[model samples]
Target chain A: MAVFVDLNISHTVDKKRLQNIIETAAHLGYSTVAINHVVDLQQKKQEIGKPKCVSELFDQFPIVQGKSRPIKVLNRLTLVVSEASHFRPTNEFKSYDVVAVFPKTEKLFHAACMSFDVDIICIAVTEKQPFYFKRPPVNGAIDRGVFFEISYVPAIKDSTMRRYTISNSLSLMETCKGKNVIVSSGAEKPLELRGPYDIANLGLLFGLSEGDAKAAVSTNCRAVLLHGETRKTALGIIHTMKKIEPTAERREEEEAPVLKRARTEAV
Target chain B: MVRFKSRYLLCELCVSDQSSLQLLDDRAVFTGVRGAVCRAHGDYGAALCSVSFAVKYLNADTGVVFLRCRKSHYRILWSALPFITHLENRGQKVPCAFNCLYVGGTIRTCQKFLIRYNIQQLHRMLPHCHNEAERLEVRRAVLNCSLKSLEKEEEEDE
Candidate 1:
C-alpha cells in the first residue's frame, strides 16, 4: 500500500512547535509531510526567499507509526498569486521540493490550471470560491498532473469555513470528478492534524467515491510529489546525475590486476 | 431467519495530556460521536447512527473504546469519527481525537484483534522499560493474557 503523505503542514517560525507538529504527524501515521511557506504577492514588498534547510528542524526525525522508518520532511513553497505578474518562476522556487499556487482571480486560476509550473493548486477553503471550476480548466489541470489541495484545518476551526470547504470541494469534484485532488491538514497546531484514514473518510464528505476518497490521501499525493520532482528534471521520464569519480588508490589497485591479466594473456 | 449484523469500531482517544483521558465516559463519547455525525452527514446520518448505536466498552485508563453500530450505517459513523475533535463532559471540553484502530463485524473478532494488538504494544513497550521491575511487569502482563486466552480456548473445546 502507498504510504500516507500530508503535503501541507503550515509553516511556523516557532521551532519547538513545528517539531511538535511533525512528531504528532509521525505518531498519526503520516510517512511524509511538507512544511508550506506561503508568499502572498498581493502584499507589497513580498519577495520569494529560499526555504530553510529542512534538516535543521529535527535532530532525529520521529519514526512513522507502523512504518518502522523515520518520517520524511520536505519544504514546499505556495505562492498566493492575485495577478498574472505575481507569479514569476525564479531560482528560489527550485529550492523547495514542491511548489504550489493559490489563485485569487478567474484568469489567474485558469493560468494556474493550464500553464502554471506548480504541483498543487490551493482551492479556497476559508472563503467561498469566487469563480466556478469550469470543466475545461479543471480537466486541463488533471491532465497536466496539477493537483487541487483542500485544507481541512479551516473546516475544523469554524462552521462557516466548513460550509465553504465542502461546497468548493464538491464543485471542484463536479468538474474534475475527484481526480488529482489532495486533502491536506494545513495544520499549524498539532490538534488540527487528522490521521490519513480520517481524511480519506472526510473525502467522502467532499463528494469523492470510496476509492477516490482514499486516493485523495495516498496515491494522488504521491503523484503530486512526482509532479513536483518533474519540475526539476527534463520531463520526469529522463533523469541524469553526475557520476562519482573513483579515487586514485582504488583505480591504481584495480587497473594493475587488469593490466597484469592482459600481459599474461599476451605472453 | 434473517439476523442483524453489527460493526464494532475499536478506537483510541488520543489526548495531548494523558490525564484528560480519565474524564471521558462512554456517554460523553457517544454524544460526541452523535453530534459529529449530525454535523458531517447531517440529519440522515444522525438518524442512522441512532439505530443500534452504542458504546460497548470504554477503558478510561488506556483510552480505548469500542463503539457498536449497525453494519449498514457503520460507514456514516466511521467517517464522522474524525470530526469528533473533543468530547464535552460536565461543561468542560476534554480535547481529544478518536483514532479508529479496527472495524470488525463482531465483538468477538474485535476482542481477539485487541488482544493481539495489546501484545504487540507490550512487545514495543518491553524495550522502553527503565528498570528490571518494569520489564518483568510487562513480561508478566504478556504471559497472563496468553494464558487466559489458552484457558478460554480449552473451555470452548469441551
Candidate 2:
C-alpha cells in the first residue's frame, strides 16, 4: 500500500516542539516526513551547511498510528533562489535526502521547472503569486517528475494568509490541472499540522478533484522522493555492493549437478 | 405541506473549558461555520451554506449542536468544519473545535443517534471514575438517565 508522507516540516531550533510535531504527524498516520532546512539565497552573509542528522532527533522513532513500522524521517534542504546564480550544484546538497527550490521570480520559476536538479518546486503561499503559472513551465515540471509543493500552515494561522493560499493554489491548479502537486504542512508547531485526510479535503478549495487531492499526500510525494534518489546516482543507475558468498555457494551446487550428468553419460 | 429536503449535522463542541460552551448559541455557531467555509472553500461554498442553513437544535450543557443545510451542499459545510479553530464569543476567543458525530437526513434520526452516542460515552467514561464516590455518582446518573428516557418512551407510547 502507498503510505502517507508529509514532505515539509519547518526545521526549528526548539527540539521539544519539533518532536511534538513529528509525534503528532505519526499519530495522524504519516508514514514518512521530511524536516526542511530553508536557505534564502537573496540574503547576504548566509552560509549553506550540512543539515543535522534526522536519526539523532529521537532515541527511538515513533511508530505510525496504523502502520506497524516506525515513521521514516528525512532531511530536506529548500533553496530560495531569486537570481539564476543563487543555486549551484555541490556535494553539500547530496547530503540531504531531498532538495527543493523556491523561485522568487518568473524567470527563476521557469528555470527551476525546466532544468533545476531538485525534487520539489515550492509555491509561495504567504503572499500572492507574483507571476502567473504559465503552461510551458508547469507542464515541463510535471513531465520531468518535479512536484510543486504548497504549504498549508500559513492558511491555518491567519485568515488573510488563508486567502492568499487559496488564490495562489487555485492559479497553479489552473495551469497544472492538479498534476504533480503536493500539499504539505510547513508546520513549526504541532497544532498547525493537520491529518492527511483533512488536507485532501482542503485540496478541493485549491481546485483539485477528489482523487488528485488524495494522491497529493501519497503517490506524488513518493514520486518526489524517487526523483530525489536519482540525484545521488548517475542517471538513476545505482551500482550496489553484491555479496560474493551467495555466488560461491551457487557455483558449488552447479558443479555438483554437472559432475553427476557427466558420470551418468559415461555409465 | 411542502417537503423541503435537508441534511442535519450532529456535531459535538470539544473544549477544555466547559463553561465556554454557554456563550455559544445558534448565531455564534452559524457565523463560525460560515466564516470557516468561506476561508477554506471560498465564496462559492459560503453562498451554498447561506442558502438554507439553520441551527435546528443546540444543547449548550452537553455541547451538542444540530445544524441543518441543503442536502447537496452539506458536504461543502462538512469539509470546512475541521478548519474552525475557535469561536469568538463576547470579545473572548474560546479555544475549541467541532467534531461531527453524525450526518442524518432528518432531525429525528439525529436525535436518535445522539441519545445512543451519549449512552455509549457514559459507559466509556464509567471506568475512568477517580474514586468510589465518583463511581457511585456516575452509576446513579446513568440509571437516572435511562429511567428518564424510558419514561419518555412510555409517555409517547400512551
DockQ of each: 0.41, 0.20
Error of 2 at A206 (Å): 1.0
Tens digit per residue, CA lDDT, model 2, B123-157: 54565578999999877875675557755763563
Which lDDT values do the candidates have, in the order given?
Answer: 0.86, 0.83
Q: What is the interface RMSD of each candidate, in Å?
A: 1.5, 4.1
Model 1, position A144: C-alpha lDDT score: 84
Docking category of candidate 2 = incorrect
lDDT of 1 at A65: 74
Mark the regions of model 2 whose C-alpha exceeds 4 Å error after superposition: A234-267, B1-31, B38-47, B50-69, B89-91, B96-158
Candidate 1 chain B minimal-lDDT segment of 10 residues: B149-158
User: Candidate 2 chain A: minimum summed lDDT over ten consecutive residues — where?
Assistant: A234-243
Q: Give all candidate RMSDs, comma-separated.
A: 8.2, 9.4
lDDT of 1 by residue, A1-267 (tens): 569999999899999999999998987889999999999999999888888998999877887777678899999999998999878888687688899999999999999999888999999999989999898888899888899999998998787888999999999998889888999999988877887887888888899998998898899889989888876555554443433665655665665555445534543
CA-based DockQ, model 1: 0.41
Model 2 whole-model lDDT (C-alpha atoms): 0.83
